[model samples]
Target: MASKDLAMGMTFLTQTVTGILANVVLLFHYFSLCFTGYRLRPTDLIAEHLTIANTVIMLSKGVSQTVQAFGVKYFSQITRCTVLLYVYRVARGVSVSTTCLLSVFQTVKISPMSSRWKQLKAKLPKHIGLSVFLCWSLNMLVNCIFPFYSINKYSSKNTTKIKYFRYCSSGFPDKITEALYAAFVLFPEVSCSGIMIWSSSSMIFILHRHKQQVQHIRRTNVSHKSSPESRATQSVLVLVCSFVCFYTLSSCFYASVVNFSIPSWWLLNTSALISTCFPAVSPFVLMSCNSTASRLWFKFSGFVRRR
Candidate 1:
């Protein structure tokens, strides 16, 4: 037990530090580009927002998980729990919604000239700020119920059971209210998932058609470097796939908690661990997909090694 606790604490600490470093590096890359007089692309703007959201996720969720892993018991305090829960939920929701937007935006950006969505290219850039603003506002409003639904007291304290994750739950009301609250939370999430799926599908279709066109033009099976569009498509696919894998795993565990299904302490720990994986992994994904960030990271690493 002691060894396991120590391992978990180390894991949480490593994840927290690594995630923060990745985001900081990515942000610095963008700032460097701006300082050197390069105009920020729409994708760069979205990447900046996404990095900020990831940083928040790492800080809030990472601290909570680290504290829990060490059995700190600080979350047992109602005020602490409320603040942590609010920050985690708000940050997480924004991250999810932002990813959906990024996927969709990239899809539209790469759409063929004759495609229906290609018309959005001109107007989309103008709405980027509005869209990001609305995403943050909507998610903030969605998470407003955090205080109402989170308490430092365990569900075991109440006769009327409520589903809850590792932390204390405010013990929801009767069936009707619980159903309503669940709907409120799940609605935007479901919508975001739908948008991501649609955008991913569109991206795949466009890539396939482009590939066919190129093959037809060449009439040969010759190996060639990937086009910029193809590279962008591949990157989006990776980001979407990673998000789906971690999101699905964590969502299943979260559902178990909400349904009051887990009986073991280990299961709760597993859920917490799964929930934090995406945030911990996401910044690295962004850095890998972004060429400027990748180059900057390599340069920085070389300079450090030489020192």
Candidate 2:
């Protein structure tokens, strides 16, 4: 491999491994809590689902791209190309959808009793499982076209017609067909983005009101420490901000892949890195916000030290 390719491969491997481990630690934390007879909170349930989706996303997209960087020809078969791409797209969509659900759920939880979203707070928990299931199913079905469109790595005869990646190429969709497919693929993403914006905005409004109330009462209260609600809101706000940033970058990269002829390896590497970042970073953010996660982290650290 070229020096730059080697460097990119190493970086990709490091990011992928770190993301995988972070998510595993979170899953272990949640399961340990359950094993100790602690009832899982609704947020905990969402975190669990998010962690699993992140793990799948990292493995599917990150590992594949990393291996490709090393010039390994794993996606030579049409079936393999389709399957890998399908899994990556589906997992990516689920990650976005789950984050949207998480943001909306958090907003509803903190809404005032008379607020319209408060009506959803009660029903959210009951439907969370089903909602997650539907998200997976919907993405799976929508991205099913990937396999049909993915060209085998060894199929060079048709490369001139389609946009080819290092190991696989996308099917040539005529202008109208491509536009329609793009719209179809983007519907969930657009919906998720809209939900995140509305939820995060409402959360900011609520937090602002809450701070005003705290200001009025600060003179009488001895402690000015942040409440759990405040901490959680901060964490979720960070999640929203990070997702928006990363998701926008990823989307730009995707657009560039279509619009820019002869895209560079650096662009590809950057896209992969941006796509994996949220899954890698989100578990740590959740861990910081939850007491149980923190205790579990200390316990795990002690166990590691002893070993």
lDDT of 2 by residue, 1-307 (tens): 7999899889889888878877888888878878999887777787788888888988888788878877787755654577777888898888898889889888988888888776687888899888888988988988988676676544546344566555556655466666787888888898899889999999999999878867978878899888898898889889888888888888888888767545677776787778888888888788889877777767776887799
Across residues 111-218, which tens digit of lDDT does each residue of candidate 1 receive?
A: 888878766987898888888888789888878887766654544554356544555645665777777988888777778888888889988998888888788655
Give the local distance difference test score of model 1: 0.77
Query: What TM-score, computed on C-alpha atoms, does each candidate reach?
Result: 0.89, 0.91
- lDDT of candidates 1 onward, in order: 0.77, 0.81
- Models, CA RMSD each: 2.8, 2.4
lDDT at 255 for candidate 2? 84
- Model 1: colliding residue pairs: none
Best by lDDT: 2
For model 2, the superposed segments whose C-alpha errors exceed 4 Å read: 74-76, 153-160, 295-307
